[model samples]
Target: MALIAFRRRSPLPPAEAWRRVTDWPRHSAHVPLTRLSTEPPGPTRTGTVVLARTGRGRLGFDDPMEVVRWEPPGPDGTGRCRLVKRGGVVVGWAEIEVRPDGAGSVVSWREEARVRLLPRLFDPPTAWAGRRIFGRVVDTLLAAPPRSAGGPGRPDGPGRGARRRGT
Candidate 1:
């Protein structure tokens, strides 16, 4: 399996940073030829299955991951989540952690993944690709504006329903 790990710092608060990183669908925006969806279609929690389909029509693979652990940032401003890949073509695990930083936050992503039928000799290139791809995912997520809680048509503007400090 290829081991991938990296960290990024964001000016957003820990909660906001956590929200951005954990929003499953947003991931596909940065990964080429990929689209993400979640099982049960609600707030993410333990057991939520994230399905990522990559490739062009008929020539693709599904990467399904089950959330084994879910802990959103609380008053202390720290959170962690773990997902286990349960796909025929991809297998491994990924973990994400977010913590408070000085007036901001830091998020870390770690994964041990391997494509089915791939040889161990390819681990280096796999790790390199994973790092580059996921690194861009994280950076773009943090840089984007936070999404609105109620979405379009809501009386309030975007992100209005999002939890605020002391709320």
Candidate 2:
């Protein structure tokens, strides 16, 4: 199995960081040729299934993952979510954690994956690529937008859309 793990620190608060990291559909925006769908079509919890379909037309594959554990951040508390991949083409598990830092928060991701029919010799490269791709996704998700000149917003800062408009 290919194993990938990494950590990132962000200026956003723990709850905000958890929210950003756990936003399932947003993942499709970051990954190429991928679309996300959740079962039960609402707030996620244990047993929620997140499906990611990738590829073009009939060439696509599904990476269906079921939430095995879910915990949102509490006031001054850490949050954690774990998912188990249950697709014909992919199998493994992933865990995401968000915790309060000095004034912001730190997020960590760890994943183990195995592609059907792939030899174990390629695990190293697969893990490397997974790290690069998922790391970028995490970075993009955690990055905070530039604050407006003097406008007041959340204590952490303005939303990503607002920061983009300022530029």
Candidate 3:
């Protein structure tokens, strides 16, 4: 079981941040590779799981996820969100929280995903990419949530991603 955690600071409040996360599918445009399905979904909360695809054609690894748990921070200011795998054995989890610091919010992400027996093929690169991806995600979120639309926002599209080390 490999583990990687990323913590980011957001200019948005806990409530607003929570709203956006729980509403991932609608905001799928902001993420790198994700596809929303037409099937009816459930409310956004602890134990509520949502189904979605990934990569170019996600239909191949058809699996849904369970939200598991959700904790809202107090007025002093700090909230947390946790999620776990649902049906399939390919377990993947992501946790993001916000702590109000002065004016801006401190966002944190902790994720540990397992691809079962396919470890040999998707380990190193996955770890390497996770770190960079998290940073890019943070940068994108810092830019005032594009008001014209509602969804996750990225610095740029696929072709214009942050220049990698060697590139």
Candidate 4:
């Protein structure tokens, strides 16, 4: 598997980012080409997150995904996520995590892709693309600030479990 990671700090508080990441259904609102479905077989934590993404013309159509392992690190928490599926085979994976910074927080994402159709000789290209895609996603999240936590009329400060997930 090829590994790629990107780190970025968000302006929003930990609570805001936690809520946004756990609520997968609403993710498409912030992320482009990413349609995440929260409801699926099994518990939401380890449950499957289906994504329909249309890639290049060569990819043929919207790429279907079977996602699992989702988490938002707490004040003292650690987390990771991964994915797999390519045509009739499984060849994709990702591990994302977040940790508390001094005032805000930092997110680190590691991803890997292995396509069977392509010979092993193309592993370098796959790794390069993974880095680019993961970088863009992290950048987008940093640019879009999160909504205030708590609820309407009543804003919340930080929660009890806000911890650091980056180096």
Candidate 5:
């Protein structure tokens, strides 16, 4: 098993930081060759299944994770979430925590992942890759603007369609 953990501090408040990190689909923007989708598509909560399909068309594998715990920031500005990976290729659990820090916030991500058929000797490399990839994901998520309700890159929004048409 590979254990991965990292923390990032952001200028955004705890609530906003939580929102950015918890928006599952946005994760695809940062993870290469991966697209994320949620079952019962809507707001995520306990029992929501997040499926990440990685690699090209037929050459891919699905990493499905079911949210077992969901806690949004409360009055004290602390939130936590946990997900269990339920997939044939990979298995483990992940946790995300957000805590208030002065006027900003701190986000921590922890995961215990194991890829099937892989030997224990690869644990160090696996953990290193996980940290690099997930660290970038979290950093990018926090830096980007929050997606509007209409969603990013929607043609219906003002000037969006025109921009797409290159007019």
Candidate 6:
């Protein structure tokens, strides 16, 4: 099993940061070759099922997860969420916490995972990769969109897209 923890500070408010981080669909845009689908679709609360499908058709696997705990930010500006991985290929749990800081917010993610058929020797690499991937996801989710239409890049934010040379 591999245990991973990542933490980052965002300039956005706690509520805003929580919303962005918990927006499951937005995760697919940040992660490569993966798609997230939520069942009992709607507000995410306890018991919501999230399935993350990775890789291409026939070559992919599903990481089924269920929201075991869901607590959105309140007046005090602190929130927490926990998901339990229930898939055959992956089994573990992940927790996300958002806390308000001075003029911003801090987000923390912790995950413990065990991959079936994988030797313990691979755990370190797994943890490293998990941190790398999840770190990018956090950065992407926290990045502020262009302030105006004239700002560089897409309104959705900077990413791979058409470039008009010599404009």
TM-score of each: 0.87, 0.85, 0.71, 0.63, 0.88, 0.87
**Model 6 per-residue lDDT tens digits across residues 32-79:** 898887898777999999989999989989999999999999999999
lDDT of 3 by residue, 30-129 (tens): 5467654423354566766666566675335544766667777677677787877553646777787767755666667677776675655686676667
- Which ranges of candidate 4 are over 4 A from the true structure? 20-43, 55-68, 77-79, 84-90, 147-167
Put down candidate 2 lDDT per residue, 7-106, tens digits, no spaces. Answer: 8878788887887778787777677898888998888999999999999999999999999999899765799999999999999999998898788888
Steric collisions counted per model: 1, 0, 2, 9, 0, 0
Best by TM-score: 5
Answer with 4 or 5, whichever has the higher lDDT: 5
In candidate 2, the residue pairs with backbone N, CA or C atoms under 3 Å apart (3 or more residues apart, or in different chains) clash, namely none
Q: List lDDT for all candidates, in order.
A: 0.83, 0.80, 0.57, 0.53, 0.83, 0.82
lDDT of 5 at 113: 96
User: Which regions of candidate 1 are displaced past 4 Å?
Assistant: 148-167
- Provide the RMSD of all predictions against the true structure, rounded to 1 decimal: 6.5, 7.1, 5.2, 7.0, 8.0, 7.5
lDDT of 4 by residue, 1-167 (tens): 56566666665555555444444444444444545453364345655755545443465334445556666565574445555554343367666666666666666666666666678788888677766654544554454434456433222322233232332
Worst 10 residues of 1 by lDDT: 158-167
Candidate 2: which stretches are off by over 4 Å? 144-167
Flag clash pairs in model 3: 27-151, 73-78
User: Which of the predicted structures, 2 or 6, would earn the higher lDDT when compared with the native?
Assistant: 6
